[model samples]
Structures are given as C-alpha cells and as structure tokens.
Target: MSTEKPRPTFQMDGHDVPFDEGQSILAAALAAGRYVPYLCYHPEFQPHGSCKVCTVKINGRTHASCTTPAHEGDVVESNVDELNDMRKGLVQFLFTEGNHFCPSCEASGNCTLQAVGYDLGMTSAHYSPLFPDRPLDASHPEVLLDFNRCILCELCVRASALVDKKSVFSLAGRGIQKHLVVNAESGKLADTELSVDDKAMSVCPVGVILRKRRGFQVPIGERKYDEHPIREVAVQKQKGE
Candidate 1:
C-alpha cells in the first residue's frame, strides 16, 4: 500500500491547479500551464515582487502573485479584464518612465518589458514621458550600461550578490530618484569585478546591459519574442519547450 499525500490544489479562474509545498501562486500557475505575466519574478531566484506585473486577485483581494504563497482551496482570479487593465496601466507607466526606443535598442525583440507591453495590448504609453537625465556607462572594456532603459527590476543586483558572489550592482536613492548603481569606489563598471559571462550580465530583462560589440547580431524579426507572444514563450520556456 503506497500512502502518499496528493499535491495541494487551488482554484484559479475555475481551474484546479496543484502546487508543491512552498510554491507561490505565480509559480504554481506557471507550472500548471497558466500564464501570469511578470517582469522581476525569475524562477531561479527568490521572489522579488517589485514589478507587480503578476498581480492577481486572491479571495477577492488584490495581491502580487509572485510573493503570495499558494494555499489549497483558495480562490485566485487571473486573466480577468479588471486585473489586465491594471496590468496594462502598469506597463504603460514603465514605458513612459523609461527611454525605451524599441527600434534602436539591441534587446528590442528579446526585452521582457517590451514583450509584456505587447502582451497587454499596449498601443501607447498613456502617461507623458519622463525623459529623465540618466547617464550611459561604457567604462567597461566589454560591457555597456545604459541607464536609460533600466526598469529598476533589480534582477542583475540579485544575481550578482547571490549567484556571482561579487555584489556588483545595487540600487540607490528613494522613490522617483531611485536608480541602479555599480559597486565600485570609483563608481564605474571597469572598477568592478563584473565579467561579460557573469549571471548578472545575462539576467537583465532590458537593454540596460549589453555586450560591447554584440549589437543586433540576430536581427530584429528573428529574435526570441519576435514571432511568439511573451505569454506563449514564457510558459513554453517554463515547460522546457
């Protein structure tokens, strides 16, 4: 007689979704082939609900799904008009806040922010552009840091501290003034121990981090999220497709 406990299940949009012992609602939903859009929630790292792109209604309450733990029998509502409208507004705010000129960006087709915008049917940034005066850093021999496109996702900061063990990046200031900074006395990438091959370099979801010589090598239309929508690509990637 095999006595094994069944995985705990939750009700998400009229579907029964099973989850592991410590899985978050977002993680469980993605694992169950349900797409909850996100920006700063990477599966490999601890949940940093900074983006709020994966916000969903649980038991009639709004919550960031990436940080909220999944409980059996809880009613979670995703893929709804109200929640999606809020998400679209959030995406638009991100676009207007950043200088994301997709046509000239190297990470144009592969950028997660852009992909999420497209997924949410964002035709324009409903808000006015900020046009913040951010500086570009090309001090590193092999890397380029463009603060103009940074969405303050902090994936690189976490990756550097946790995976790379270099603590190469961090955020500074508060509220609207808050921005990413390099961890160096001279405040430059060339002074830090960041390498082009570090996990931090590859974790940025936008064009903020780019290799010095590798710009648009794959071309625009043939990039990862070019033909497929972010929802399809993200779920497929999670399923190892």
Candidate 2:
C-alpha cells in the first residue's frame, strides 16, 4: 500500500492553501502565489520578524506572517481592513522615521520602503519627519552608506555575516536610538574586506547601501518597482528563486 500523508492546508481569506511542515504563513502564501507585504523577510535569510509589516490576523489573533508557523485550517486574514490599515500605519511610521525624500533619492524607484508606501497607497508621511542629521559614508571606493535613508531592516547585516562570511554591520542602541553600525575599529566600511560586489551590497532593501556610478542608471521610468509593484516583485522573487 502507498503510504503518503496528505499535505496540510490553511485558509487564507477562506481559500485553501498548502504548506510544508513548519512553513511560515508568509512563506506559504508567497509559495501559493498570494502576496503578503513584508520588509524584514527574505527568501535566502532567516526570518527576523522586526518590521511587523507582515502582520496578519491568524486564527483571530495578530501575528507576524514571516515568523509565525502555519498549521492546518489556520484562518489568516491578510487583506482585511483592520490589518491593512495597521500595515499602512507602520509604513507611515517608517517613512517619518527616515529622511526618505523620494523625489531626489537614488533608490526612489527601486527602494522597498518607497515601494511599500506605494503599495499601501501612502501619499504622505502623515507626521513630521525626524530629519535627523545622520552622516553619509563614501569611504568605500565603489559603495556608499547614507545613514539618513536607513530603516533598520538589517538585510545588509544578515547578508554580510550569513552569506558573505563577514560581520560588517549591526544594530546598536534601543528604541528611538537604534542605528546600523559598521563593525570595524576605524568605524569605516572601507577598512573592512567588503567588496563592492559583496552580497551585503545587493541585499539592502532601501537607499542606505548603494553602489557607485549606478545612480539613476536604470532611469526613473524603467526601474524595478516602476514596472512591477513590490508585491509582485517580492512574491515572484521568493517563488522564482
């Protein structure tokens, strides 16, 4: 007799969906072609659950979809009004927390933060911008670090240590004071073994970490987010990769 257990399924917006054991709600949803917006979740990296952008109503309770494990018959309410509004508020908070002036930002069209704001229909920051006088680091020959644009996502940190095998970045300080720091005695990225083509350089989802000589290279009308929205790009990236 054949011996194979039927795959478990969950109900995301009342639609049956299959998921592997221990798979997160966001993972399964993306695998099933249902895009749930997220920031701190990437296909190649472990879930950090920091952004809370993927918050969904799981079985009548709020949970971060990127880290919350999926189970059979779990009812996940992602597109509901309450959750979408909450995610929108989070997007606004992120906007105000950084100096994300999209008009002149190099990462404007391709940035996940700007893209997420677009996805959420965010027309304004809705609050005063912090406008903190953060420093910019062009110490590296082919890379730049603009602290003003950082949203503390830590994708660079994970890519540096986990993928590139170099501990180049970290989060230091508590709430309202947290910041991304370079791990070097000289507090400079040029002093590290960080190449321009390092995995960390490509993993940033914001304008903070950027490559030199490529600013506006793709042009505004033909950027990644310009063609396909972040939801589609993010979901396709997870499944296609």
Candidate 3:
C-alpha cells in the first residue's frame, strides 16, 4: 500500500490550487496557470522580493508571494483592485525614479518595465523625475551602461555572479542612494572582465545595459513584447500551456 502524503492545496481567488511540498505561493500560482506580475522574482534566480510587485493577500494579510510558502487551505488573493492599484503606483514610481525616456531607449518595446507599464495602463509618471545626473558609462567599446534607465532590479548582479560565474556587478548604498556598481578598479566596464557575450550583458530588464553599435537593429514593433503583451507571454511561461 502506498503511504505517500498528498500535495498541499490552496485557495487562489475561488479556485483550489495544488502546490508541491516546498513551492512558494508565486511558484504554485504560476505552475497552476496563474500569472502574478513580478519584477525581481525571476525563476532562474533566487526570490529577492525587491520589487514587491508580486504582493498578494494570503488569508486577509499581505505577503510577498515569491517569498511566502504555499500551505494547504490557505486563501490567496491576487488580481484584486487594491493590489493592482498598488502595482500601478509602484510601476509609476519606478518610471519617475529614473530617466526612462522610452522613445529614445534601445530597449523600447522589449523592456519589462515598459511592458509592465503598459500592462498596468500607466499613462504617465505620477511623480516627478529624480534627474540625478548619473553619468553614462561608455568605457567599453562593445557595451554601454546608461544608468538613466536602470530600475536597479539587480538581474545583472545575479546573472554575473551565479550564471556567468563572474563577480562583476553588485548593488551599493541604501535606499535612494542605492545603485549598481561594476567590480573594477576604474569603476568601468572596460576595466572589468565583462565580455559582450556574458549573460549579464543581456540580463538588464531595462535599457541600462546595451551592446554597442546595436541600437535600432530590430526596429520598433518587431520586438519581443511588440505583438504579444507581457500578460500572454507571462502566462505562457508560467503554465507552459
């Protein structure tokens, strides 16, 4: 006779969703074909919960879904007006936090930030731009670092250290002063050992990192998020359906 324990189940919205033993709420939701909008919780990397865009109500209390574990009989609420409105506000804050001039950015149609903004129906940045005068780093002949569009998501940091096996990028400071830093004596990519083919090169979810001499190569309306919205792609990725 088999004596295996059954997988746990939870209530998301009005549906009974089953989850594996050690899966997070976000993981279970995505696995069950539910798309939870997230920024800092990529499946390839460990959950950081930095963006808090995946905030969902679990049993009438707020929790970061990517970090919170799923348990049996737990009630999870996502896609409600309250949570989505907060997501929109956070998206707008990310917009105003940097000089994300989308029209001029090379990552225009392919930017996750831009895609999420469109997904959330963000018409304009509700807050004023910080305009911090961050310098553009073009020290590398094959890459460019435009800090203006950086959302500080730290995808590059994770990819470099974990995927590429290079300790090249890291976050510095706290709160408003927080920013990405290259591990180099000259504080530049040219001085660092980062190559054009590194995983970190293509890991920026925004326009902060770009390959040199490759702008406008694909043109507008032909990008990844051009025809299909992020919601569709995200759902497809989650459910594998």
State every prediction's TM-score relative to the real structure. Answer: 0.97, 0.95, 0.93
lDDT of 3: 0.88
**Which consecutive 10 residues in model 1 have the weakest lDDT in total?**
1-10
Per-residue lDDT of 1-241 in model 2, one digit per residue for the tens?
A: 1249778999999888789999999999998888898888888899999999999999899999999999999988998888888888998998898788788889888888888888988888898988887889889898889998888889999999998999899999999899999999998989898997689988888899888888888889898999899888887787775
- Give the range of the ten consecutive residues with the poorest summed lDDT in model 3: 1-10
CA lDDT of 241 in candidate 3?
Answer: 46
Q: What tens digits encode model 3's per-residue C-alpha lDDT throughout 1-241? A: 1249766799999988889878899988888878788887787788888898999999999999999999999999998989989999999998887888988989999898899888888899888888887899999999999988878888999999998998788899999888888899889988888998888988788898899899999989999799999887776777554
Candidate 1 local lDDT, residue 24: 98
TM-score of 2: 0.95
Give the winner by TM-score: 1
Per-candidate clashes, comma-separated? 0, 0, 0
For model 2, the run of ten residues with the poorest summed lDDT? 1-10
Q: After best superposition, candidate 3 residue 158: deviation in angstroms?
A: 1.1
TM-score of 3: 0.93
Q: Relative to the unseen true structure, what is the C-alpha lDDT of residue 60 in candidate 2, on a scale of 0 to 100?
A: 96
Give the root-mean-square deviation of each candidate in angstroms.
1.6, 2.0, 2.3
TM-score (C-alpha) between model 1 and the true structure: 0.97
Best lDDT goes to which candidate?
Answer: 1
